[model samples]
Structure formats: structure tokens, C-alpha cells
Target: MKRIIYYLTALVFACIHFVSCSDDEVEGTQALSVASFYPTIVMEGTEVTITGTAMGSVKEVVFPGGIAVSNVTCIDDRTLAVTAPAGVSEAESALVLRSENDEVASRQTIRKANPAFLSYQFADKEGAMTGSSMTINGKDLLLVEDVVFTLGDDVVSVNALEMTRKSNTAIKLVVPKDAPIGEGVQMAMSFKNNTSMTLPAIDIQKGSGGGSWVQKEVPVYSGEPVDAGSWSGSVQLAATLFADAKVDDVIRVYISDCGSNPQGSLKNGSTWVGLTDDLEYFNIGDDAANGYYERAITEEMLSQMQESGLIVAGQNYVIQKVSLFTAVWVEGGDEETTDPITPETIMLNDFEDHDGHNSSWDASWTDAEATEFPVDDNGNVYLRLAKPLDGWAINCNHQDIGTVANIENYVIKFDIKIEAGVTGASEAAMQFVLADNWLWVGAGLFPETTDGKWMTVSRNISDLSAELVGDLAIGKASNGLYGGVIPAGVCIDNLRLDPKK
Candidate 1:
């Protein structure tokens, strides 16, 4: 009986040992989750925050290759307010959470930001001008006092008689007129706390120094309507040559000079060639620093802008140079007499070279016949359609010659004024054609078929069938003189030949 009792007691002791060991193992195990911020949070930054958590105890918080956390205050049992001191490198930093017994959890991310200034943009009720004085408007400018503008260490100081607080984001100041032009143009605005920003380019003219527009008759070109006038390539017709805003506020057409690249800078689109396959929307060329539109097309393209074609087979083409108020169609060339396309043929070949083939339109004179394409004092001309059109199409043989490889897209940029009459119809507002090797390939694009609105249109170049790269054209479809019948008016302006990049 004594021996049996001893065996049972030993077994019980073994069970208790196992249980205690299991409990110790659980306590020693650790887990942690650390917060991550894509752009490292600066000392005083307040945009976004990500946190990392550990299942076990946390000991020290270390920043990878950066300044260690100085004053860490425990907000609660799980949160800590970590202070990132200044003077750390502007590189990525890893945050590590170490627990007791050497267990640790880490997160790799950008270093916490410092209070370094980035830039300042000065503008006011009137507008941002060169002579206008403005100050800092962002956060963490508390220690700012005297601001210094610099370029690559060149310092220029502006006297601030008053730093009026227009709001949390703006300050008013008085700038010296004698400030240097080129060097002082781009200033690095530094504050008393060492936090500074680079100022943006400012405009000098606050008001229109030029005179108002005056009615003056302009000579019409031989081919153009009596009301239409010719604008030579040499003239900087900022104040004189203008289409009716009602017909088209934004110009989608461009004129190029001889020996110039047909391709212009394209904004809001792709860059590389032969690789891009999608052409969702069109964009315009990059605008210059000045608000006025400059020469965007090559000289060669300009020479071909108004090419006349004789109808090879069909009825005589009624070619009239009337100012299009709204939507209208223009053909690039007459159809092939030998190859009459039928419904059995693919849609790509249906409209090939159909320039001014079938379209009709209306024209209105913004200023009476007293002046041809009215000119403002600054040589700026303003013409717009009295009403808007529902839809329109284009077919031009102008393609970007600089494009060499697999042509992926043909982009066009213009403004659409819906309120004037451009109404967004169903799936028929805008459309485009795509081709490969000059053979019928496909047709995929959205055509603008709305009334009373101004909008930008960009059709995919790959959508055209039968040709992938080479010559291209744009136009509309109608059943009138050349498949164009205008019920509503649509203005077109600022035409551009935008390359993907």
C-alpha cells in the first residue's frame, strides 16, 4: 500500500511540472504590430498614421538608422507618443519595437519628417503678380520671422512692413521693386525657425494694360467666306484672329511651320510610343507660362491644314469656308472609285478619306460684317457660337510625323461648352477609327453627340481599323452637302496634335 501511494504522487508531480512549463512558454512568446506611414510623418506632420501592435510586452522603440525616440509618453496601455527630434537624414527609416527577453518587431518605412519648408505661392483677390507681396500660409511657421529668398545659396531679402494674417494659409507683405529679376525670380523663402519654402513664379501685370477691342474690317481670303479673313503665319494674332466662343471656345486645331516636328507636348496622356494601346481621352499641349496660346503645330502640318480635294466619283463637293457655329463634318479625301465599300465590308473602310464628304453647318457673326473676325486692342479675337450643337465629327490626314514606332493613339484637345448647347447624348457623343497596315482593322471610340455644353474630347487612335500607324484623319458624319447637317451649333477651337507623352 505505501509503494502504490508513492507512485501516484510522482505522477501528480510530473503533471504539475508540465502545466507550469506550458504557462511559462506562453508568457515568453511575443507578438507586435508597428504603425507604417508611406511618406514618413514629420515631427509635426498630421496627414496619415499607421500603427504596429505586439501581442506581448514592448520595451524600447528604435528608429532604423535615424535619431532614437527622445521623450516617449505612454498615452495608454497600447499607445505611445514618440517624438522624432530634428537633424536626421532625409532617407527611409525603420522603426523597431523591442520587448523583454530580446524579442522584437520591426516596420520598414520612410523617416519621420522635419519642419523644413517646401514652397510658398502668393496670390490675392486681384491675382498673383510680381509686385504683389505675400507671406507664408502653411502650418509649422510659428518660429518664422524674417523670410529670405535664395537660389543655390544666393540670398535676397525682401522688407516686410506688415505680415497681415489674411488667414491660416496666407500672409500679406510689401516687396521691394528693385529685387533682381532672374536670380530673385526663384527665391527660397526661409523663416526665422529655419523652415522655408520656394516661391512660385509670379505675374507682374495685375490689370489689363492693353486697350479694348475696336471694330475693323479685315480682308477675306480668296477661298474663305466674305465674312471670314485670313490670318498669316507671321502675324501674332492674339487680339485679331478669333473664332466665335459659341462655335468653339477651346481650339482643337493647330498650325505648324515648315521643318517643324508635327508632334506637340501632350498633357494628361501616355509618354512612351509603340507600347501604349489604350486611348481613352485626348489632351492638349502643355500651356506656356503666359496665359496666351502659342504656336503648337509644325509648319508642315499648318501648310496641309486646308487641303482641297476634288470628288473623284460622287456628286460635286460643295466646298464653302463658312464659320462653323457648332458641329459639322469635313472629309479628308474622296472615296476610292474602284473600291465602293458595302455593308459587308468592315466599318473601318467605310469612312476612309471621307473629308467634307457629307456635312452641313451654320455660321453666325459675333460682331457684325463691319469687322472680319473682330479684333480686340491686344489683337485678341473673341468669337463663340450663340448656341451649342449636339454632336460633330472630324477626319483629318494630319498625323504626328515624329512618331516612328507602333502608333498607339491619336489625341485631340478642345473645350466643350455644354451650357451653350452641347448635350451629352447616349453612346454617341464622340467616336474614332483605328487601323493597322492600311487595312481594315477596327473602329472603337466615343463620339461627342450632345448639345449645350463645352467638354474636352480624346479618342483612341488604336480604335481605327485597317491601319495601326501612318497617316491619320478626323471629321464628322452627316447627310448634307458632305454628310454634315447642323440642327444645333457647336463651337470648336484650340485644335492640337498632341503626342502621347
Candidate 2:
């Protein structure tokens, strides 16, 4: 009976040992399987919790871009934590996990995070103004799909055509005029195939203000005419205002032929009739004072009037009553300040009209040939210089400045673009000459290498004395002489004289 009891005990112990060994072998051979990961889409350095079976022995976690994840920790048999790696390419990639003897991977890709919001501002100013260009700077900006602005009840969406992708770090766009004005205006940017984030509120100021018009009529002519060799005319027209005028408020001068008995009322139908359709309005700019305005009746203005049949050249006409009209901004309205009108450019020749020749510019050549031609089907014109035997000269006469006794307050400016890959010349030079008694000369040399870009050349003649008027001449020179064989050509435009501001 004792022997049988001992044998039974030994058998029971063996069974217990066998069961323990089977359990250990099953645990050691368990196949790794990933169920899912929390927050699958994460930014760089974001901690992720991966839940699955057989994750206790996780030795490595590989993120997108084949980058090894850092700060990995295996919590237990079913949970693991890891920090997403940085420098991942912009795409969805598989998340890989490795153990001592086996590896497991999630079927779902780990997507790269959306672009992070930083800041934005106008390109030229500290704050964005209506119609101003704005730039947004941030990290991973290339992922951005669209940008929108919230203005009161209105939602302004930036058009793709208006937005310029400057680079991966910057985007440029124009601020819509209807953008809400006040503090805490919200802006949001969205990314392609990803979530969007809202930036902090921005302050928007009142971009425009209101004003009233006060008009005063003055004489027709300001000074006597002087002979400018080519043309002569008396400059005139000055008006006054009672109110403090804003920069955008313009003083309009209306004229009528004699015997019209025109009333100068702003609303009278007869007054509108008197201001004929041919010569309807003359916009005069504001002077230094808010109440002062002036419009010099230049020779060009006279020519325009004559062409419009409002007046006859070399014919005397009676002076009718002159009326002044001013358009003022209204408060709390949609009216915006008009862009300040640039002063009238004398001797302006953009080559857009008259076959690349203006009334004031006369083409003269010495050792080169020039032709006025349009660059494209758009009718954009330019003066093309080609096949230069030596060099060329073009003369422009500014009657208004030449006629003035003191011609010391003008600037001559023009644009030049040399063709790329121009060869056969050691150097090319440009020479400017003011050829009468008040002689002035200036020259600019082109570098041996050029990128075929347009450059503006300007010379101020403020200090030169004006005893007599002469022609303004421009020419190209090579090796101290006016002539050379040009393999590639050049384009010239926007030749004009501006009053020194």
C-alpha cells in the first residue's frame, strides 16, 4: 500500500511539470500580430500608442522614410509606445515593427502631418491693406491646398490664380477688398488630403476714409507761352477748394463753348449737355495744400482738345464759364480711396501706339538700323535695334521743358533690355546728350556678360542751366565710337521726362 501511494505522487508531479513546459513553449512561439495604432497620422516627434498581441519584445519601430523611431517602449505583451520619426517624405508610408525573431507591420499607412501654421503679413507693409499683396510663411507650406479669410458674415476664398506659391516656406496672395475690418479677424489654411488649422486672429484697420468736395473756379491760363523750338503753348488752369481734400479726391474741370449758356450745377441735365461728350472731363490733381488744385493746359492737352473737335487749332474761341466738380468719399460706404494720380508724364513714349514712334520722338540713325515693330499679337510694341554697322541715335524733343525759361527740373528716363548670348563686342555703351546751349551728357556701359534683363536708365538735369532749348539725343556707342556689328539685338521703351518730385 505504501509503494502504490509513492508511485501515485510521482505520477502527479510529472503531469504538473509537463503542463508547465507546454505553456512556456506556446508563449515563446506566439506569432506577432498588429491590431491597430492610435493616432495613425502624427507629426514629427509625436508619441503613438500601438496596441497588438506579442508586442512585449518589440525591439525596433520604423516610421515612414525608413527612419528608425526614437523613444520606443514596450509596456507589456499587448502594448507598445514610440515617438514618430522626423524627416519623413510627404506621403503615406507603412509603419514597421520588429522583434528578436519575427516582425509585424500595420496594414494602414502612417501619414505625414499637415503643414503647421506660423504667421502671415503683407509683402510690403507691416499690416495687410485692401488690394495689398500678402505673404504667408510657415513650415511645410507646400502641403497647403487653400487659404480663406473670414470677414464678418462673408467668407472670402482666395482664388488659385491670385495665390502664388513662392516656395515650400512661403506663399503670396492678395488681400481681398471685402475683408472684414476690425480686431480678431480669423484666417484658416487647409491642406490637400489632410486636416486644416486656424491661425491666431489678426487685426484689420479701416483701409479708407470719407471726405467732401468744395470747388472754386480760377483763371484759364497761368503763364505766357515761350518758343520751345518745336512747339509753343501757354500753360494754364488753376482751381481751389474749401474743404481739406483727401489724397483720392480729384478736382474735375469742365469747359463749354461760348453761347452755350451752360449752368455749372452738378445735377443739371443742361450742365451735362454743355460738357460735350468729346471733351467730358479733365481730372486735375491736388497741390501741396488740401484746398489747392492745378491743371496746366499743356500743348498735349490742346492737341487732344483739337482732335476731339472741342476746339480748333490756331483759331480764336470765346471763353465760357468754367465749372469744378469734386467726388468725395462717403462715410461707412464701399467707396475706397482712389490711387493717387501720377503727374502727367511729358515726352511719354511707351511705343504702344503710332508704330513705336510718338509725336515727340524722331528716329535718326548713323551706323545702325532701327525698326518699330510689335513684339506679339497683343500689339505690344518695342523699338528693335539690329544689324548695326556702327551705332544709332534717336532724338526726342520736350517742348514743354524746352519752352520753359528754366529747364533745370526734369529727369530723362528709359528702359533697355539687351538680348541674351550677344557676342562680337568687347563692351557696349549708351550715351545721352542734351544738345542745345544747355549741353548735358551722360553715358552707361553694359557689362561683357548679360542675362537679357530690362534695366531702367535715368538722368536728372536739375542743376543744368537753360539759356536755349535743344533736342535730347540718345545713342549706342562701341569702343568710344558710334558704330558696331551687333549679333543680337536690344529693345527700348518708356522713354519720357518726369518732373523732379
Candidate 3:
């Protein structure tokens, strides 16, 4: 019995010793240590390798800002790898390595990457002229400290006041007037600590013209229209030729309004009287060019001006005189030229002869409540538009008056006024359309005047002859109403087609 008991005790002791050895083998005995890490600076999502002992027991790696790295793998007991978490802060942060039972930290701190260049574009993405507003779209724009434009050796530094940071993705700037004008201009941005890659080339258009040229003012009239018999019969108007004038060079003749008297001294306030057929450039050596051009002044021309408010029949008078100016196009000379005016004034409509009939006037509306016909009070007639819908109200008239045949020689003028408490007032526009040809010209009225006062709007249709060959209709261009934010009521009067002056 004693022998059996001693043997059992020995067996139990042996079993206990074997179990203790197995448990020791399962728990790691190596101490965690970090010798070093590669890439002291790291961008988000970059894989980092740590060379140290007992790395296989690492549970997780923590970066600054509570960012925990995922997909950690232990290559061996001495090397560990993990994908860096997306950095949330711009500052540098210490790295923390956590094991199942211990933790180790690195002395070095990793920082978020600096801004990187991707691409850029103008606000319109098409291009911009100098002095025009432009927008740049790119990444990390918030860190941009300064933007520089480069064209060969010439550089333009944008004024600090000119740049506006709209967002992290967009910056607004005005194309500086001195910015180099050419294709493939380089743009670059500098950050607090780094500079971005230069953007692909961009195009900037030429700005307004700047230069000098010669100007000569030829006398339009030395005497009165009546003295020249221009009021009743054909009159001869002439100007002396310049010595250096070329045969092919252009000579534009203009008439001046010698308010009240023939000998009124030419001054800044002197008005140039424009007549029909005046804007046409006459070759310096052309018809009867014998140092002069003759125009027939008849009763018809005088009557037309009297009817239109251009000249008061008895109170105001037009001299049978014109001023001639000459210009020649040189390879690198100024390209800007002014058109001459000829006086062939005609009154298409004064709203005085409505006669209670639509009488050559038609009212059209879109999303409008009502259209008021021409109302006359003491010879002053006006057309009123009320409750215009999203689209504007237009009062157009078509006449077989042969005006459209030579539309280039004429201009349309009218008085427009916005009524108080009107909606979509700023969105109101004026348009002249030729229905037969479907050609139309329109402009916004709000830009010139914002108050409710009456304002005269004039447009030269000289270049629109091809489009104005059909019956003419004048009204508001169809602009989508701003959800009824603009005034809805307006007044229009004195719609007329007068010879360009």
C-alpha cells in the first residue's frame, strides 16, 4: 500500500510540471522594444514599417488625434507593418505602439502632408480678358499663401487684397491688367512651408487698347442752314483737304449743333449733329472728292428732324455744315475708330397718334396679368405694363415704312420708367425684333438706371441690317423672371426710330 501511494504522488507531480511548461510556452516572454521606424514624415494611408523586437504581439498602433491604424501585420518578431490612418490635423503627432500587455512610443512625430498641386482652371474655364474677374479651382487652396503668374521672364504678383479664398477648393482673383498676354502662362501657389507644382499653361486675352494717335476736327458749317438754302433746296457742303491725306484713307463727316447761332465757338459742350448717310466712310479721293463732298439738303430732311424731338422746329436750327475727320489703318496703329453721324432724323412713334387704336402697336406678354394700351394725357402718351409674369411685357409695332430696308442707318430710342412697388424691375429689358427674319437685339435696362425715374435708352442697329430686313417690333427681351423678385410694372414712352445721329 505505501509503495502504491508514493508512486501516485510522483505521477501527480509530473503531470503538474508538464501543465506549467505548456502554459509558459503560450504566453510570450519577449519584451516589446521599438528600435526605429522608416519615413519620419508620413502622409495619410502610407504604410509604415517598424523594426523592433516582440512586434508580433502588437495589438494596435495609435497616431496623434486619436487616429488608430488598421491592417497591422507582424512580419516577424523584429518587424511590423501598418497602414497609417488618414491624418486629421495639420500639426505633427507622436506615434503610439500598443501591445496586448505593453505599450511603446516613438520619439519622432509624423505630420499631415502639405498641399499638393493637381490642376487649376479659370472661373469660366474658357479664358478671361485682362481686368476681368477669374476664379482658380484646385486642392489645398486654403493653405495657399501667395499666387504668382509667370510668362517667360516677366512675373506678375497678384495683390493680396485681390485674392479671395472662397473655399478649400476655389480662389477668386482678377486678371491683373499687367499680366503677361500670351498662351501657356504658368501659375503657381506657395504654401506656408512648401510650394505647389506649377499648373498647366493658361490663356489670357488682350486688355483694352492703350496708345496715342492724331485727331483733327474739320469745320462742319461756316454759315447757317438757311443761308446755304439747305432748308428749301439742295445745298452744297464742302471741307478743305489736308495736305498728307491719302486717297484710300477714310474721311468721316459729322454735323455739329450750333445751338441758337451759326458762329457758336466749338467747345467741350458742343453737340455733334449726326445725320443719315453720315457714318458711311467716304474715300478721301471719291465722288466729287475734289477736296469736297456734296450732299443734297431738301425739305424732306428738315421735316423729319422737326417731327422727331431732335430739333425744335422754330426754337432750334441745324446748320448746313459738317466736320470731316480722317484715319488710316497701319500695321501696328490704333484699331479703334469712331463712326460718323448723319442727320436723317425721323419720328416712328411719339405715342401721340395712338387714336385709341392699337394703330401700329401690338402688346405681347408671357406670364403677365394685363397689358395697358397707350394712354394719352395732354398730348403726352405712355404705355403701361402691369403684373408682368416671369417674362417681360413688350409693345411692338410693324410698319411698311421701308425703315427695315436700311436698318443700319438708323437707331431706336425710347423712354423707360419703373413704377414704384413693381416686381422684377431690375430684370426688365428692352428689345427690338424683326419678326419676319426672327432677328432680334436686346439690352438690359436695369444696368443704366435703377431708380423709378424715366431714362432714355438708345441702341444703334447699324450692324444689324442683315437681321433687320423684316418688319420691326420693339419690346422687352424674354428673360426668365427671377422667381418674381423684380418689379412687374413699368412705363414706356417715346418709342421711335430715328436716323443715326
TM-score of each: 0.24, 0.31, 0.26
What ranking of all candidate models by TM-score puts the best one first? 2, 3, 1
Residue-level lDDT of model 2, residues 343-416, one tens digit each, is 33443444322212242244434532454433532223456566543454444432222222123446656555
Each model's lDDT comes to 0.29, 0.44, 0.44
* TM-score of predicted structure 3: 0.26
Q: Which residue runs does candidate 3 get wrong by more than 4 Å?
A: 1-361, 365-369, 374-377, 390-392, 396-399, 403-405, 421-423, 435-443, 446-450, 463-486
lDDT of 1: 0.29
On lDDT, the candidate that comes out on top is 3
Better of 1 and 2 by TM-score: 2
Candidate 3 lDDT, 1-501, residue by residue in tens: 000000000000111111111112222767777777755545565567776667766777887677876457654455567766675456777778787678888877765655555545443345766655566666555545567888999898763333532335666655666888898888877653344556667788875533212222333333454321223222233212324332222232222232332221111111223334431222222211111233333233333323331211111223333333322221212221212112223334433321122322445444434546544322235556555544434433432222222345466655566665555555544345433333234335443333555555666765545544322332222211122222446666544455553
C-alpha positional error of residue 31 in candidate 1 after TM-score superposition, expressed in Å: 64
Candidate 1 residue spans exceeding 4 A from truth: 1-119, 125-392, 396-405, 409-415, 418-424, 427-430, 433-453, 462-487, 491-497
Better of 2 and 3 by TM-score: 2
**Backbone clash pairs in model 3 (N, Cα, C under 3 Å; residues 3+ apart or in different chains), count:** 23
